[model samples]
Target: MSVATESVPVFAIAPAEDGQIAFPPAMEARFRPGLAAVHDEMLAREEVIALLCFGSAPRGEAKPKSDLDVLALTNGTEYWKRSRMINGVEVQLQVGPLQHWREDIEKGNPAMIDAFATGELLFDRTGEATALKRDAEERFRAGPAEPGPKFFQRQRYAITNIVLDLEDMAEDSLEARVLAGFMVLEALRFWCAAQRFWPNRKPWVMLRQLQGRDSSLGAKIESFYTSYSSVHAIAFTDAVLEGVGGRLYELSTDPEPVPS
Candidate 1:
């Protein structure tokens, strides 16, 4: 539980008075023993270079059912995962090559960037984890790239196809319902990307972020979910499409000729 003082990174989460990593109280109380067990096991392996705790637990947003998410940086070539249930909480462990993780952060992988930026360093042997976390934070502060022409084209293509299919089906039919689901997902993705926001997978988190950015659109989306009507769904889709130059009835593409 004690890290070498010299090896600890300056940017790491502050250690406790006893020199152990400081975890949120709820997380510590529920997963301390289990975390210790896994930490010991990973530390015993020579290839394991560092361990970081991420997600809700380390972020102080844990609920009663939140799981502990740990990322193990290693010198291995392959990626793997291990999951265990400890005291009714899931202990999810992800092991991967350190270089691979660094590449992911450099490439703007949203989840990976978020994890390293906010993760608590539980163990660091070479200070590389701290460096990666620093890099992630910089990227996060810079925010996501603005959506380009290709991004809008792809979104419009998919959405236009979906709307076309919906137009041919009865509004209350099962097929229309299924297509409505796809429309909603596409709309959310388009809206988030246009607003330069990282799309969160969690429902409530996504909704809150969406509302923060555009209250009118967010309220419209919420109403669709609340009423479960096809009319509301179509209206929401139209609103999102309007932001990106309206619905496309016909899309023209000019293919690049293949080089011989």
Candidate 2:
């Protein structure tokens, strides 16, 4: 559970009602049919024990155009294919060889466990999946984050991603600008979570967080950044980073333990 001093950062999403987080409603409705389709395929293979949606769709935070995030626990990967062109999109489905699938459950990668326990089950066979999900949820809630190394280890990917995202902001492409802004917010959330400071997963939070670091950038993003407009935010972000002389390094490499 110990993370390296230079591990990636972790992010915490705003807690929704009942500790729930999810994709936007419109996006969820659009994805439900697809979930049905995937479930049907699983049943056909007889390999799927349970299927649940994860990520923004289930979390109620998805935009109009978000991809589906599915967690499936199957008996084996024998029935699974590496790259199936499902309607031309490459859906990255992680499968475990039957025995490995069980091992994943034992090892606590209960990604499938959490999805089933907290998620709306699109399909379930034999009812064992539901029981497994409930058991997994109990374990997740009962356990405390081991803190220190554990917390830092979880943050590494997020921090690394944030760095790359900043690099993307320097691009001239519209898509790059839009994605860059999201990455910026994501990076901010990671930093905040590492310090146990939670930020709302919406724009207002972004503006507020940026304002603490750079007022001008905050003003620009607030005025120009919109649910409908990312270009304005991108331009302001460029200015903000420049003004700060560079990006903010939220972590120190002193190797000293963080003071409680």
Candidate 3:
């Protein structure tokens, strides 16, 4: 919310007929068994209260090799892994206990909320996911909430560290900078969301969304990732940093005032 000076738009996926979401053909072929497996897991136990599918799989941007992002809310007493692969497809779960959903919000993790805001609700036990998602959207419509000091601090800190990393990579040959290119892209993605731009959780999707926000910025980033393929790491880094040093500063520091 505070992270973006430009009004950040909320993205949501409306379900198709028959109440099922779509995936790319190859993705569905490979990923469905795993989703079904989760469905079975949820059905077999009362502890699993909800299942959600976000990112490329639900949005149908996935290619043959795409993985899934799932949020499974369970009654387990503790949180779980951030990611785990099933059937060779990596599933990035914000895997935590039921309380973690509330934590996701309170921590000012807007992307997590945007995931639910835009994602397809795969399973909702007695409408658990549906009800909570509506509440999340209400907050979204209320406008971007400032992610607060820690969120801003973390984003700025991470960016600072990455610049230092670029310095370290400079002494090395092309391969090192290539790796650094990836790191830069990641930083760019985080900065976008940290500024409340909210691209669904994928590199290309995020790139497109960035382009949507500013065509020149988008094309410049895409050109590097495409042409040099990170061979020109310094240029790539510079191009990426152009997105920073603007409204992000204002959004990160100037939160909406709290009434006493």
Candidate 4:
């Protein structure tokens, strides 16, 4: 068939010969000058309390395709209109009062909390942002902010329903099963929410995350065929169910017959 299958975005995430994976030096060489410039410009501001070199670049595994995420903790009451770009790299300069940013973190603003928790300190002239970063790490380590019983109850209900729908679609037409896979992904969002796990920005990353819990998840998910046949559809659903069994906390029995 002439049909195309889209591949997930490839990160040039290669480990060195020593099997150690860290920030690739070439990317640092390419990206550092621009980041240094941005740091200088932002630090010169009196209202800017904290500036960080965060996201992929700070983590050091960045590819040329990676965009830099910079956070600015500020004394400004009003929010900035938008993030600006520098040297083909996107700089997310979120300018707001430290208290306001902390409020968002406490409420479990996933992106902000993750960034603040792991971000490298760029310039902390007042030391306030450094304190906030510590607070963010403590909060993040405490995990998912106790999403409550109602949240888990809703997710269990959603998981049961989505499982059943996939079971039914597994016997039907290809179009129907494809739709069911989309529905399965929808159910996974709830599952991730209930787990307080970060939803993978890329779908394939989930398999790696799952592999940490169940090593064979990679092989299990890969059993799904190239054309995405019903065999693959059903197999993928079963693998997902396997992941649910192993990874999810306090799972409800799928009202549908458990995928064999």
Would you list the C-alpha lDDT of every candidate in the order shown?
0.78, 0.50, 0.60, 0.59
- Regarding lDDT, does 3 or 4 come out ahead? 3
After superposition, the stretches of candidate 2 with alpha carbons farther than 4 Å from their true spots are: 1-27, 77-92, 97-102, 105-117, 149-260
What TM-score does structure 1 among the candidates reach?
0.83
Off by over 4 Å in 1: 1-19, 25-28, 63-65, 75-79, 256-260
* Local distance difference test, candidate 2: 0.50
Clashing pairs in 1: none
The worst-scoring run of ten residues by lDDT in candidate 1 lies at 10-19
Residue-level lDDT of model 4, residues 1-260, one tens digit each, is 01111322222122222322233243466666566666666666778766666677776767777777766778778777345567776655556677787788767687777788877766555556666677778767876755676555655555556555666663558766676567546544544555567645655555455546644544544554344455555455555545444223354444667679
Give the C-alpha lDDT of model 3: 0.60
Question: Can you give the lDDT of residue 10 in candidate 2?
Answer: 27
Ranking by TM-score: 1, 4, 3, 2
Per-model TM-score, in order, reads 0.83, 0.45, 0.58, 0.69
Among all candidates shown, the one with the greatest TM-score? 1
Q: Candidate 3 — worst ten consecutive residues by lDDT sum?
A: 1-10
Model 4 ranges off by over 4 Å: 1-27, 146-149, 163-174, 187-195, 225-227, 236-260
Please give the TM-score that candidate 2 achieves against the real structure: 0.45
Q: Lowest-lDDT window of 10 residues in candidate 4? A: 1-10
What digit string (tens of lDDT, one per residue) describes model 1 on residues 1-260? 12233554544333223345555554557777667667767776779878888888866778888888999999889899999997777999999999999988887899998898877778777778877877888888877889888778878878878877777889889888878877877788778778887757876776677889888898889888887666777788889899889887766667979999
Measured over all alpha carbons after superposition, the RMSD of each candidate to the real structure, in angstroms, is: 4.8, 12.5, 9.0, 13.4
Residues 188-249, model 3: lDDT tens digits: 67656655664455676676667777676666666666655443444545555555542132
